[model samples]
Target: MSDVAALLSLARAAKARIATAESCTGGMLSAALTDVAGSSDVFDRGFVTYSNAAKQAMLGVSPETLARVGAVSEEVAREMAEGALARSEATLAVAVTGIAGPGGSEFKPEGRVCFGLARRGQPTQVETVEFGALGRAGVRQATVAHALRLLAEALG
Candidate 1:
């Protein structure tokens, strides 16, 4: 069984639910969590906000945050996590934003991923990871894995 499945099982045992807000990794994180049997008890919903406007409209991410930090920054990720928690019954929410690309830029290069986690009545936690030069698919997969781990940690 995948670690995500185990994490979901733990969450179910604790009577806690999780929600996901994803970008770059798309809905893969949600897919992974729900892939396990009986995940419906633990996973509440998922948001696939690939665009800044979508993030704002769907998760209540601020336009100011997007303009200040871009779509793939810690601010946006935190806002996404907070919004997901506010919008769902889930006790924990995870958000991912990044540029998983084959092309690199001087500032936000390829394989740059940011993650955020929000818990009920708690401050949102945000972090950034750079996978260096991994290709698009690899970076995305890694981001999904990291997001799952973050969700598990938040659940605990």
Candidate 2:
């Protein structure tokens, strides 16, 4: 089965609901989850916070955190996950923020993605990945796969 399908299966088995907060990947994560049959039972909602303002307004990612660490940082990802969990009726939440680009600075290179996962009663988890110049679509696809894996792991 696909990673998204596997995640949906696990979530359904556990009767857990999920939410997503996405930045560079846009709504691809949400689209992937909803692509599965009968995902509504397990998939709650999605926040497509593509901008710093949107992140703050939609997912409550603090402006201070954004200023301190930037949108692609682990801190913002964690807050996005936590905020999604708090705002939605979901039992679990996953977040992704990245610079999936053909352009990147010397410091934050292209294909550098940050992820966050949160379970209702558990500590929020954050991770950073360097996919290394995979281009925009490639990096986004990789991010979706990793995000699904994180959700599946949390379901376990």
Candidate 3:
């Protein structure tokens, strides 16, 4: 929670209004940010695009991209972040899509999360992280922490 508070402070200092686009973690990333006191000024909105339709309708993620790379890919994550910035009053947006589960295939394993960081007027960045078989809750929590780190690095 202290990390989250410090993150809010960093956003405050930079005047970076934040938005989130989430998938497997549900709204946990947004929940973490909003759980901190005084986050309303920094957090503009959150998009919980749990399904492909929601991703397309809410975040404007491309159907072609989803068809080619699937929902958990960096391509989708990038679109989600870019879409968040496009739809929100926020200056900074973060997106996460992943499989946090007790089951996964050989290609995309459990505890695999993709993240995107988009800052207005700058190139959006995307990355994939393998937390490696951590249970559902652990992976989700780790994803939130890593997303916060990405936000901090972007803020810096």
Assess candidate 3 and give its lDDT: 0.95
User: Which pairs of residues have clashing backbones in candidate 2?
Assistant: none
lDDT of 2 at 12: 86
TM-scores for all candidates: the values are 0.96, 0.97, 0.98
lDDT (Cα, tens digit) per residue for candidate 2, span 33-138: 9998889999999999998999999988999999998999999999999999999999999999999999899889999999999998889999999999998999
Candidate 3, residue 94: Cα displacement in angstroms equals 0.5
Question: Candidate 3, which segments miss by more than 4 Å at Cα?
Answer: none
lDDT score, candidate 3, position 71 = 95
RMSD (Cα, Å) of model 1: 1.0
Ranking by lDDT: 3, 2, 1
**For model 1, what is the error of residue 116's alpha carbon versus the real structure, in angstroms, after optimal superposition?**
0.6
Best by lDDT: 3
Q: What digit string (tens of lDDT, one per residue) describes model 1 on residues 4-118?
A: 7789777977788899999898899899888888888888999999988889999999998888879888999899999999999999999999988988688999999999999
Clashing residue pairs in all predictions, respectively, total 0, 0, 0
**Per-residue lDDT over 1-156 for candidate 3, one digit per residue giving the tens place of the 0 to 100 score:** 498898899999998999999999899999999998789999999999999999999999999999999999999999999999999999999999999998889999999999999999999999999998999999999999999999988887
Residue 54 error, candidate 2, Å = 0.4
TM-score of 2: 0.97
